[model samples]
Target: MTDGAPPRARSARLCTLARCVALAVALAGCAGTGPGTAPRPSPAPRTTSPQELCTRLVTHWAHRLLADADGGYGDYQSMGLSNGQYEILRTVLDAGRAEERINGAVSAKELIGHQIARSCTERYRGGGPTGGPWQ
Candidate 1:
């Protein structure tokens, strides 16, 4: 009931008032800028270790060379390999080939992986090459 309105009009006014209150509450919630509503900090960037990078490079080139039936070493400079990495690749491939002959292709692939890991770790143990950038 209202002072000058009929019962139906009073109900309509109450409904509109309720709708306004609900809208204001919803907007207030969206406008919040408290600590809990702050944007989350981005995650730290991931970094690859030198040894891991070396292993990846050598392993990728080794697989490429092994897959090519022509048995070409290709241009190491064009392959993005450092001098040291190229040497590592050559050594690993030699062993890989011997392993393939003795065991199987699968054994050779496994040996390549192990050798790359070991070689890269050893190469980077002293904080990578100090001779030059391409070493």
Candidate 2:
């Protein structure tokens, strides 16, 4: 339906309509919540168990220490390992070394993994150290 309007007038009307539509869309988003609306609750954070944490730490350091015989990673405290974890590492490494000599590096690495998992599980079986905090 032409209203005998000039092209400029038609274009201006279209522009105004577009602006109104945009404003309506923008306002619709903000209409979801009012002043009385309560905020959504966030999800609770997940926590790692002591056994799992010990397993990860021991596994990481065991691999590194096994690869480098020069003790390049520093002491137990520097490596973020407790005394108990360090003892586990030493025990695993000794077995790992023997395995490496007889079977190979691959076999020794596999043994390290198994030993670390088993030892860590046993260590945290009673909900972690009983002797002291450092244990």
Candidate 3:
């Protein structure tokens, strides 16, 4: 009999050891990119005029709030509005409600168009109140 371990046992141990070493080496080559690694940013949403933004967001939110008798107001953050922007929206919506009552939804929509452009122009006249590219 061989002085060392049996041939099959020795081969099995060597094979397992080799596989473990190969796996370790393979894993070592792959370092996961976690924090501190700047990942490619996703494409940003297409920007439009402040008036356009107001037009889009205000109409949507107005409908939502009006749909519920509770006037379930949504947060500005959810509506993608800043505090200043929301104030403008509130004023616009208030006027729109009056317009709608007197005329109809059509008149209200026209009012929104005019108010959004005027309000946004005023709100953003001072170079949009910030230097960020969001403007």
Reference-based lDDT, each prediction: 0.90, 0.90, 0.73
The alpha-carbon deviation from the true structure for residue 112 of candidate 2, after best TM-score superposition, in angstroms, is 1.0
Give the Cα-based TM-score of candidate 1 against the true structure. 0.71
The C-alpha TM-scores of every prediction are 0.71, 0.70, 0.51
Candidate 3 C-alpha lDDT tens digits along 5-109: 988998899899999999999887664555677666889998786656665776677666644567656688888877777777788778888888899878877
Q: Write model 1 residue lDDT over 31-130, tens digit each, in one string.
A: 7566678855889999999999999999999998887777786688988899999999999999999998899889999999999999999889987775
- Lowest summed lDDT across 10 adjacent residues in model 2 is found at 65-74
Q: What is the descending lDDT order?
A: 1, 2, 3
Candidate 1 global Cα RMSD: 6.4
Deviating ranges (above 4 Å) for candidate 1: 1-38
Candidate 2 Cα deviation (angstroms), residue 53: 0.7
Residue pairs clashing in model 2 are: none
Over the full model, what C-alpha lDDT does candidate 3 score relative to the true structure? 0.73
